[model samples]
Target: MITQNSINQLTYEIIGAAIEVHKILGKGLLESVYHKCMIEELKIRKINFKSEFKVPINYKGVDLDFDFKCDLFIEDLVIVELKAVNEILPIHDAQLLTYMKLLSVPKGLILNFHSNNIFREGQKTLVNEHFKNIPK
Candidate 1:
């Protein structure tokens, strides 16, 4: 079973991987660069994740053909969205939340690779009702 504590630990590791990538690459790079580096980092850490994971859409009990992709789906527990923008907008948060809802995951994170300090200004974590319902 996935408890709140387990999710928290997994989130911590994911953030650490992002920070490591940012530390080596420094920022202002393309989102693809960060995406690739994150993939390597996760592999080095033995973390399981799917890159460019397609989130299936179902409407009215019918599966849609639209392709909604998440940057990273970690351990089937978190949805991580990567960005290389000047700032994190509401749409970015919305995107992550939407992915979380679609995947029924408890946690989501937005990692912007354009800031000087990734842990401080470059990262945003969000959780939904699924998270609240989990055991701590």
Candidate 2:
């Protein structure tokens, strides 16, 4: 039953969890701190997620051994990338997009924990061709 509407709702819940973590920890913390808090928040909310999930690479019908890890892979649907930088750079977007492409995921999120507000300035959601093919 994965649809655009469902994905949107799931995204809302994920962002809410991040907001809760930011509200308590505030800014100026390390990315790992926020990462750990997010894990707890997701568990408390009963959201399914995998932390430090590995992204496999394949080339010419051969699987390559690599250690590309995504910060959070939620419900096998969304790829969540956590950051605690002063600002999100293009490279951050590229990184998340690349993960989404490699995994063939429909949606991805960049959650920056260093912003003033998680809901307002801290989150960026991106979608790719996979998303376009999903039912509405």
Candidate 3:
């Protein structure tokens, strides 16, 4: 089982990658740029992840054909959504939450890489009931 510490470490790794992307691209680039760069960073780090992973939503007991594509699913335990907005918005969190529910993931990270100062303004790690229910 994935632990909280593992999730946090992965978040920090992704945050470091985001900071680097921000440093080179700076603010104002579209979210796609950040998403692409982060994928490269994850590759360089040899981290296991699936980009645009298709998450199947359950309708009743059967798995539906339609799916939600998450930006990044790390180690099959965490979900990541990338954004390059001027500021983090409420809908962003809601979107991640929805992804978590659909993906059956315990933790998710919402990364906004367009901030002038990334350390102070660019990231959020969200934990759901699945994560909380895990034994420490």
Candidate models: Cα lDDT each: 0.95, 0.97, 0.84
lDDT (10s digit) by residue, model 1, range 1-136: 8899999999999999999999999988899999999999999999999999999999999999978899999999999999999999999999999999988999999999999999999999999999999999
Candidate 3 residue 126 C-alpha distance from true site, Å: 0.8
lDDT of 1 at 127: 97
Error of 2 at 38 (Å): 0.4
Candidate topping lDDT: 2
The clash count of every prediction, one per candidate, is 0, 0, 0
**Per-model TM values vs. the true structure:** 0.98, 0.98, 0.90
- Residues 12-57, candidate 2, lDDT per residue (tens digit)? 9999999999999999999999999999999999999999999999
Which scores better on TM-score, 2 or 3? 2
For every candidate structure, what is the RMSD over all alpha carbons to the true structure, in angstroms?
Answer: 0.7, 0.6, 1.6
Candidate 2 yields a Cα-based lDDT of 0.97
lDDT (tens digit, per residue) of candidate 3 on 55-107: 88778999888767889999888898988887788988998999998777889
> Which segments of candidate 2 are over 4 A away from where they belong?
none
